[model samples]
Target: MTAAPHVPVNLADRLSRFSDLWSQKTVAGVNDYEVKIAKLKGEFVWHRHEDTDELFLVISGRLTIRLRDGDVVLEPGELFVVPRGAEHCPVADEETAILLLEPAGTLNTGDAGGPLTKAAEPLD
Candidate 1:
């Protein structure tokens, strides 16, 4: 197989390649972590990554991460980090695009696997 060429991972461009909710496409990587783009809608399952922290950066629309304590609402250009072992559920009022930074192979549903869980797929 040929190696992928280095290029910019345009958020809008990468996102347009898929339409499934909760779908995640790996765009790039740094060290042990991978930069992923996901298009989310509705409510995601309540899950937690036992061994890795998950970072969410909102690129478009609004995202609300519901924790046991409260809901963290993120708008465009906003970001939040959910620490390891913290159970949380993500909700989107509308179609939302987000960039996720987490360890490679980290499951989208984390410890709680169900129908929404998906294996990360590389964009290129």
Candidate 2:
């Protein structure tokens, strides 16, 4: 076995490689967590992670994390963590770029699996 190369990841460059909405692209990994990126627009399914928290960091545009209680709005360079088991729906009025930090293999659709579910593939 060999160690993976340590290198800097350019978020903008990685984001540019993909144009699909709601699809996650894995950019890097740390321990048991994966650093992923996605472009979001409109609304996403309401879902919850049963075992791990989900972190969403807005890279560009605006993101509204709709919770059962209310909504958490994030601007560029801002981030929010949705606690485990808490249901959330992410929405964006325009094309929004975001970075996600979660456990490896965590599903994008969480507890609500459907057509929008996407496995995070490595960026190319």
Candidate 3:
């Protein structure tokens, strides 16, 4: 497929295209990584990316990254980078929108594949 050139990606506009929690859609690609967006709520399975860092940027609402030591809370416009191999589970009290950055083929659920795992789909 040919890339859509010169067009800007509007995060909120792209995010509105889906309502499923934990569903990820690839909005753009940067070299070997993909810029993805997801709507999140409740708790996600505990997992970790063994080879690549995961960046979570809150576009709207709040999210808590639950780590073994403690939890990192992120509000709108905030971001957190979970280092490679660091175990984490994301929790949101309310519906939240987020942007994720990781290697193109990185699994959303890491090694803890289950119902929450989502294969990246192209942005519609």
lDDT of each: 0.91, 0.93, 0.91
Error of 2 at 13 (Å): 0.6
Ranking by TM-score: 3, 2, 1
* Residue lDDT tens for model 3, 13-117: 888778888888999889988999999999999999999999999999899999989999999999999999999999999999999999999999998888888
Span of 10 residues, lowest total lDDT, candidate 3:
1-10
**What's the CA error at residue 102 for candidate 2, in Å?**
0.4
lDDT of 2 at 55: 95
Per-residue error (Å), model 2, residue 88 = 0.3
Comparing 2 with 3 on TM-score, the higher-scoring candidate is: 3
- Model 3, runs deviating above 4 Å: 1-3
Per-model TM-score on C-alpha atoms:
0.94, 0.95, 0.95
Clash pairs for candidate 3: none
Show the lowest summed lDDT stretch of 10 residues, model 1.
Answer: 1-10
Using lDDT, give the best candidate's number: 2
Tell me the tens digit of each residue's lDDT in model 2 across 1-124. 1125665788998888889999999888899899999999999999999999999999999999999999999999999999999999999999999999999899999999999998998884
Q: Output the TM-score of candidate 2.
A: 0.95
Task: Kindly give the stretch of ten consecutive residues in candidate 2 with the minimal lDDT sum.
Answer: 1-10
What global local distance difference test value does model 3 have? 0.91
lDDT of 2: 0.93
